[model samples]
Target: MPADQLTDLLDPARWDPLPHPPAMEYPLPVRRRDPRTLPPAPATGSAPEVLSRGADGVLLRLRHRAPRARAVALHASGWWRPQPADALDLVPAGDGWWEIVLEAPADWRTSYGFVEHDGPGDPPWWEAGLKAPGAPVHPDALCAHRHGAARGGAERSVLSLPFDGLFRAGRDDAETPAEVHELPLGPDAPRVRWWVPEEAGPAPLPLLVVTDGAEHVEQLGTPERLRRGVEAGVLPPLVAVFVDAGEHRGDVLGVPGGQARWIPEDLVPRLRAAGLTAPGGRRLALTDDPARTIITGASYGGLTALFTAARAPGTIGIAIAQSVSLWRYPRGALVGPLREAAGYAPLRLRLHAGRFEGSMAADARALADALDGSGAEVTLDLHSGGHDWAWWQPALLHDLAAELGR
Candidate 1:
């Protein structure tokens, strides 16, 4: 009756076909006696090697042990004012540190660190390691520093159209929403699996589309989180589209042209023909202008969110990238799209990574630096844990109220 071909929606291996660093489920503070920040990479500990640089920006190698704190603010102290750029981001190793790039004037001084209301759960941001005897926390802020690292590159809009052939759906049929559905790209095509939420009733509802599919659901427990966002008004009552990854995730995500086809040739048309996508419609171009639509994932999935926005600027609005592994593809795949990307119809991005996600920080910072350089409306947060979910959950809820609603 309702696509019997779709079943076994929670298969992790089947969903997250690409390899993305794993992340924690929440962010809890680690009570350390001596609070000190790790000085500089090339100076104190091992910093990643610099790969290449151009007028666009410098591309530094990533150090798996780098330390990047969570929920930092670029305040008056000069945290991000001493570099060739004006922002920073991280790739978490979930180990002892995270990879990040500092952007500000070569000569600058400022204070910053993790920020959170001193209350119930855990402070939103905490400086894990700092050692400038009397280094002084913002007291009102975090930590201060003189001089920022040189960073950033050319800015551009990317149309994320990775299509080795890949990748949502409906509300009205949701009265008792089908938990799983097998959607064929065409009338006589190979059927791919689509996991629908158990939410009932069709009515108009927002949507959350996940690329890594099952792994996102299991590791991040997104279904539960989305359910909560809905109930709490952090997000509109929404329908979720969990697409199980087929062999081509990287192939599709690593390239751009293919992406457009996947959605146009395969994903989008199918949803429209099925009559499931009414609110967000069949593609990014058709999504709501003011309505909140979020697309996210870890590693490749995270990368795809950036790609998706580049591909269909006005289609979707909010994007969350967790431990996005940009290096998994080529710099151009990300850069080229971002450079040419347009239609910045008020899109928002939330990026997160464990303090130690390894070489992947290159991937993390590239996007963050790009977003900040372009002056795109974006927010970046980091946590103590490495690429694990224990940390991802906190970033999700912290911004829930802001992104979803009241």
Candidate 2:
């Protein structure tokens, strides 16, 4: 079945509704537009319009004006993977317009794009891999809200709905912002971007070690959010360390190999030795207690966070893993180690997975079930979106507020 059709199998009634924004209509009426006339393509940088809303979800019409293309397909994160058969076909409407209407939860958010195929039977460029040469995905010209550059600097378009309070902690206007510092550890090590909260005191603060540092900082604006979160008193004052994975991300991130050794063994010691100091010349220190140390990441980075916690419980005690690629390893392979670690010492974990993530969502549930009775304080948050940074950013802020709230 096509990716859009597969979504029809999901009953939104099964999932609880996300908190609604103030004075919003329960079921929004269809916009006033002529049925015969196609809605004009949104201006560049503007989001695609929500056509209508119903009890099931919202109706979003994705349009591509590709007159010469043989076929056009919608490629949204979590909706369509590498499989060509799963591609959401956009039917020819009128003129040069090719469009498809998607029914999604009101709180749904994701990055998407359209692909123009040479032939009807052509496979998606992503089948070869995002980094493959000539596999660039075309961003939606209409929708301007982009998230994360991939496939040789090609950014994906964003579609965000109202999800109240999920990102409320990060205020745009803040009196005091956290100070950011770049630390080049060595030629062999990943560069670290450190965020030291202005509220830093004499006492050692909790540390948050984030994997895929560049994406978290550049794409997600996590440091700014963390600063806002601290200033608002929604989160406790702490130090954030963003670890740049570079090209070797695939080699060292998720796999229980180099990252397992480097984080606790090399990175932590080096940071301690450097003695991070705030802009005010107040010497900032990191807590030695594992319970005060938190590690987080998304996708493969998420898997790495859990793996690192299990391997070095004495170094990391809390893990906030989002959209973890638990399917990477053989079934029960990663879970076994975490279960063993929990038996020795209790670990606090926040596991997030999207309902649209298919097998990854199942794997997250399985991991949560396996951790039961293992003495780990685990909370599983099944969100309404996909495996995109659109959800990951707000979800990260939500986790920080819940876990380390003042």
Best lDDT goes to which candidate? 2
Query: In model 2, what is the error at residue 392, expressed in angstroms?
Result: 2.3
lDDT of 1 by residue, 1-406 (tens): 1111111121122333335435322222221111124334452432223333344334432333323343222222112121212123243435544444432221111222222132343322223222111122322211111111111111111111111011100011123323344454564332344433343346434555666554434333445555545555455555566665455656654333334225423564345345463333432222344235566666556766765655554556567777776655545345434433433355577777654445455556667776665535666776433444334444554454466563
lDDT comparing candidate 1 with the true structure: 0.41
- Model 1, residue 52: what's the lDDT? 39
Reference-based lDDT, residue 296, model 1? 65
Candidate 1: minimum summed lDDT over ten consecutive residues — where? Answer: 161-170
Residue 342 lDDT in candidate 2: 67
Note the Cα lDDT for every prediction shown: 0.41, 0.68
